[model samples]
Target: MLVEINLLPKKEPRNLSLLFAIVTFSGMILIGAAFLIWQMNEKKEELANVENQVQLTNEILEAKRTKLADFQSASSVQELEKAIKWAEKQPYNLVYVLQKLTKILPERGFLTEFNLEKDSIINLIIQFDTKSEAAYYLNSLLNYKWIDEAVITKEKAGDWEIINNKTPLSDDQLTDLAKKNFFPRYYAEYEIRLNIAELKQAYKSEMEKSKEGNKGEEEGGDSP
Candidate 1:
């Protein structure tokens, strides 16, 4: 038993301790690398989710814009047409009557007094430079195409001849002075009155009446 114990070599404990320390260091490095890889994967997944949400929001905004554009383009024109139709249905057309009157008035003539009654009769006093002009206006009024009738209610000189009160004058002298135009010459005045019952009636009837009168005259001449 004493000879077996003496054959065993002496053991050094430092080599085993060195081997354990190296193994521990290598294991810690491996664990740190695995944790880093896990963190990187989580970051990539979060980035993908955020990108998807942004794309969805962009699509929704584009759809909303398209809907707004369609509403404006399709509905506005119909609304405008409806408004125009409404305007046509209104009844008070004073503007149109005024336009027609403006066309019928003479070039050099002007109205001195004008009045329209509640019963639709219009009193119009027209002034002209000469009696011939006044007569022409009356003829034109007789030929009017819009009113029922236009008649000359009154005719007179526009300017009155005022004599000096101090001078004694006879009626014949006044008449002579008027004829000789010792005062300013008065322009011709005509009062035209008409009814606005119809837009176009009187002229045609007047033409027919004149034709009938001419026919009667012709027949009388032919009878003997």
Candidate 2:
């Protein structure tokens, strides 16, 4: 066999495993850094979108608040105009009418219901101690300066003892009670016509003064 011995020391196999591992680790780090940057940019875009939505909602609320204020002002003016028109249509001052009616009430009677109808007719329901008291009140109303005609349209009488009895009374007891002259409570309804012509003539000067005052106020309001 031929001799194959070399004088130089045999060269060991090149150790390239460490350099390959370093290159692979560096590539993985670069890929991870790029992904993290992309995620951060996405988060920034989401925050910007939320802020824009909040600003738009605030603008819409502010517009509605302005409209509500204007509506309230218009409603107040409309209500005042309606009240003025109603006052103009009234035939007489309610307070004055009530005062006059109260002054003419009979001493033995009190008004239960009072209704004023068209053409100055008044329907009155009154309670009295006796029927005679009711008749007297009707005569007084006829003679009153403000009333033109007065008539009793309905009359009713009730005894408190009979009405409030819990147990039914025997025939003997009822007969005994009937023997005594007992006057029961009387309720009378009257219809009276007011003297509208006389009333209007008396209040004409005051009415004219009130109308002139109202006209002046309206003119002042229309100026500015």
**Which candidate should be chosen as best, given lDDT against the real structure?**
2
In model 1, the runs with Cα more than 4 Å from the true position are 1-11, 90-224
lDDT, candidates in the order shown:
0.60, 0.73
Per-model TM-score versus the true fold: 0.35, 0.41
What does candidate 1's lDDT look like per residue over 13-105, in tens digits? Answer: 578777888999999899989999999999999999999999999999999989988988778987888867854654323344445444555
Q: After TM-score superposition, what is the CA distance of residue 14 in candidate 2 from its true location, in Å?
A: 78
Tens digits of per-residue lDDT for model 2, 1-224:
79987899889986699888898999999999999999999989998998888898888888898888888888889999987786567776555556666666655457789886775888989876555667777877776566788888998865733443544765335434534654335688988887776666646766788999999999999997
Per-candidate clash tally: 0, 0
Evaluate model 2: give its lDDT. Answer: 0.73
Which stretches of candidate 2 lie above 4 Å from their native place? 1-88, 160-184, 202-224
Lowest-sum lDDT 10-residue window in model 2: 170-179
The TM-score of predicted model 1 comes to: 0.35
Highest TM-score: give the candidate number: 2
- What are the C-alpha RMSDs, in order, of all predicted structures? 20.4, 15.0
